[model samples]
Target: MYELKEREMIFVFTGPHGAGRKTVAEMSGSTLGIKQVISCTTRPQRPTEVDGQDYHFITAEQFNEAQAKDEFIEVTRVNDYLYGIKNSDIEKIFKSSGSIYLILNRFGAETLQALYGDHVVRIFIYADRDTLEQRMRESGDSEELIATYLSHYEDEMAYREQCEHVFENVDLAHTVFDLTKTLDQYLNRNLLELD
Candidate 1:
């Protein structure tokens, strides 16, 4: 049988842009009573964003140093901006009173799965081409940027197997509820074993 450990199963989630991965992360964490480390990035924060909550803002030098120290479990460059998950932050979160989900991209998610396959669970969120395009438009994403991200993550039809769960986010309300149920069971069983 596939047994998930009692300490906590870390979830590394990835999806194509506009697939609502971020929202899913937040909701999943909330439903499971855990924290979600939003991740750090060199990308400029938008007007409505905050430093510590939205992301940990870092400079190129700081990012490179963090990588050199092996402080990040996964680091990837997107459009000349560096984004990463801090190893210490993840450790502290899980070691503390709550669990934490590491929100990731395709590149980062694959890395985490490979490195921590025994302790981490991976889920992939995908959308149909038309649905992806619609979500992009609804998010106020520019065509050029959307095109760049899609090409980077590959076509919506390309196959990926690292994920244990494949969720279609076109109709996100239903998908969100279903995902919450899935995560609840995972977290509940593990938490029980820990006690």
Candidate 2:
């Protein structure tokens, strides 16, 4: 007889690039002691990124092989590099009795929601187009890259209704405060409140 393991809820932060989703996800994960699910990518790791912490960097051949095995829940190509989330990663989180958090795009968020059903909490982070563009510039992105990134804002904003919550990343402290509260309520977790 197969005994089912208890499932831990997954919190997903998603939005257009330069929306500050990653910042919110990382902070919330750290505060709650939830692990941020590292994505796998075929792109070369940047000097600032550590393997397994930033991403599971792999060869293009390895990525294709995993794809052939239907191992990825979602995959996307960005700037000629492939990035994906493995189904096994989610299973690992469930097995460890810990929740998972991820910063993904809309497609990835939808895929996770489909796989996890109600266990998945989709948060669509956003800011005004001007604010996002300014943030991208402040982050040291080239003008061309900033333009390319914000071009998809409208399309991404269209997916906002698909998410469980919409968060505006205006003030960092306030944004994280709301995010923690929302996540705690959704997961029925008391990790945030010290009482």
Name the best candidate (by TM-score).
2
Per residue, candidate 2 scores C-alpha lDDT tens digits across 52-131 of 98799999999999999999888988778899998788677666656888888888888778777887889999999999
**How many residue pairs of model 2 clash at the backbone?**
0
TM-score of candidate 2 against the unseen true structure: 0.88
Q: Write the per-residue lDDT of candidate 1 for residues 1-195, one digit (tens) a residue.
A: 122346667777777777778788777777677787668899988665789888999888898888898888678888889999887777667666445677777678778777767567777887766677787777777889778877755643353465778888767677877787777676664433221
Would you list the clashing residue pairs of candidate 2? none
Instruction: Flag regions of model 2 displaced more than 4 Å.
Output: 1-7, 191-195
**How close is each model in CA RMSD to the real structure?**
5.0, 2.8
Q: Quote the lDDT for 128 in model 1.
A: 67
Q: Estimate each model's TM-score.
A: 0.84, 0.88
lDDT for each of the candidates? Answer: 0.73, 0.84
Q: What is the TM-score of candidate 1?
A: 0.84
